[model samples]
Target: MSLARENRIDLVRGLSLLVIFVDHSNLSFSGALQHSRGFCDAAELFVMMAGMSAALAYHPASGAAGFRATASRTLRRSFKLYWIHLLMLAAVVAAVFLLPFIRDPALVREWSLDKLAAQPVRYAVEAIFLRYLPAELDILPLYMLLIAAVPLFFAAIDVAPRLALAASVALWLLAGIFHLNLVDFSQPKGLWYFNPFSWQLVFVCGLLAGLRVRQGQAPFAFSKPLFILAFVFCLVAIPADLVIHLGEYGETTPLRFLISKTSEGPLRLINALAIVYVVFNLDALQRLSPTGWLRPVFAAGRNSLPIFVLGEILSDIVTVSVFGREGIPLALELLAVFVGVAILLGFALHRDRAKRRRSGKPASSLLVASQPEPDYGPETTTEPPSIPDARPNTAT
Candidate 1:
């Protein structure tokens, strides 16, 4: 793929991450915003897009060189994520420890030191990206595991993409059947937000999409009828499930349950798929380019990881200091927070772009540089064109 296309993916991922940050921050109005129709359900979209982006970025090539290249890139990303996880862990710990010193004693009292201490071993295990950590911990362990598993998964796809997808679906079903909650596991899953077993399907679907793209096939571009059907299905399924299940419908439904944000159930997965199909087929959406004002949202999507971490830390501070048990007001305060974060993200992106431009390279090129080079063919005699050193790309 061209550099521009890859950057666009980064932009999408950044946007998804931003929405997720806003969604998970649990600031007062998020619930209502999440419930509203037009709001992007960022969590599911982020997972799905992660899969799609992975497919687009790292599908296997023709020979041993291709396989080696793919493996090296995956490994580098996995390690990078590991480092990021460490940083996030440090941030969370720092926030927890220091918030009390800066904030009122009454506010500090609501903070849960016991909860942090309760799971030392779990947090330690999470450092390896094996299990899910507590919600209070903002890091995503499962995403790291998925990153580590990418090469293996891609190898399987190279041999038999369909088989790989089938296996993923089977595993997903099994995960649901066994109620395979990573949170229940003794080891920490990669991050609190992602669970490998359930989330793998999203990745596999992305792999399938990537395989098609690598084959020079368009992964999207639905017929009008199909698009309409997908749209109707999404509209009906989401609301129907909500109405029928109502309060009883936790994220976990027996057949489809994975790790729902609500309960990590099957319903969420279905909802995610419904959303994906609708978005994938919507030609009109494709026509909608990032406007000048909205470009920052795309930039946020590109640097989703840092922005997400920043938002989480910011939310933690706000909740611990200003809001505490009472919580921020649901209306104006929530809007202000969201707008404030958006502005900050815009500024960060602007600074990052300026830095990259000054350094004489594209930001996407920088991400590629940080990643390990693929170990495919013999070392090249000719040097590849140098791209700019941009910030590391993070999933939203």
Candidate 2:
């Protein structure tokens, strides 16, 4: 893909991360930004981006060196992701404890640390094992596990691209049918909020799509009728989300349990793919310019790992300290957005500067110097792209 096209992917990733932050906080604008009004949310987009990025970085390695390099890079990234998750977990737990002393005590008893305080050692052990994640923190653990499984996914893809996808789908279906899921140490019977078994299907689809992107073809070649159907389904979701009467119809209702992020229900996966199909088919990136007003978002996407973690921490703080109180001013919400973007931009600048100092070159050159560049020369068919074997090195 062209650099311009990749920038657009970063734009979507950044925007998704931003919206996820808003959704985490109880800000009013969250309703406008949150895709949960439909069947998917920022989590779907984030995971999809991660999978595609991984494939783009590692799938084309040619020999023993490439294979070992890819494996080492992936392992390093998994380690970083796990460490970051632990740090964030500690921060979140601290926030849960600290917020009450500074704000309304009644507001956080359920959402914060009451139960955690009851059994600190057990919960700590669970968090370490990634079996006791709370709401916002759940996604991190899933990403860590998924990163660890990158090698297996690549092995499957090597055998046959379709085989990888088929395996992913089978796992998802079996998980749903047998209720195969990870148990939370905090609650022995509690299932993982974002079940990796099911969500892997979405990631696998993205990985396959990335392979097609390298070959200069669309991932899923849906017919015209299928594309139209997908469009109509997305449109219907807008109203379906607004209508509350559907819930009153009970569990048997067609829409009641149609999709679930927790189990990554089939319908939900279909809905997310439908959106991706439309976006890819239409050259959606053409509409978005990296140098345009959306540059901040693009930067955030480029540095999604730190930005997402920071955004979550900030959003949660706002949720307990500001949103939990009555009548939150619009200015405050807008200020929150500004602050988040500023932090992301500032971090980007710092990273760029530090990279330049290490490389002794222009900051832009250093930005991705660590990554192997993709080789698309005359020997492309025989030699793998030489570009960095490491993905973005960030768990989006």
lDDT of each residue in 3-27, candidate 1, tens digit only: 1132334444555555545555555
Question: What are the per-residue Cα lDDT tens digits for candidate 2 across 1-396?
Answer: 233244545765766766666676766656544533466666676787677767666553666666666677667777777788788878767766665654445434534344567788887887788877653566767777776677678777878978777778889888877767887643324677677888888788877776666555555685899889999988886566445223433134454445555667666677788877776666556466655676666656766776777777677777775635663788977897778667766775566457558768533210111233443221211111111011110111
Model 2, which residues run further than 4 Å from truth? 1-5, 28-37, 63-65, 98-100, 103-112, 185-189, 220-223, 244-256, 323-327, 338-396
The global Cα lDDT (0 to 1) of model 2 is 0.62
**TM-scores, one per candidate:** 0.75, 0.81
TM-score, structure 1 vs. true: 0.75
> Largest lDDT belongs to which candidate?
2
Compared with the true structure, the alpha-carbon lDDT of candidate 1 equals 0.52
Q: Model 1 misses residue 11 by how many Å?
A: 5.5
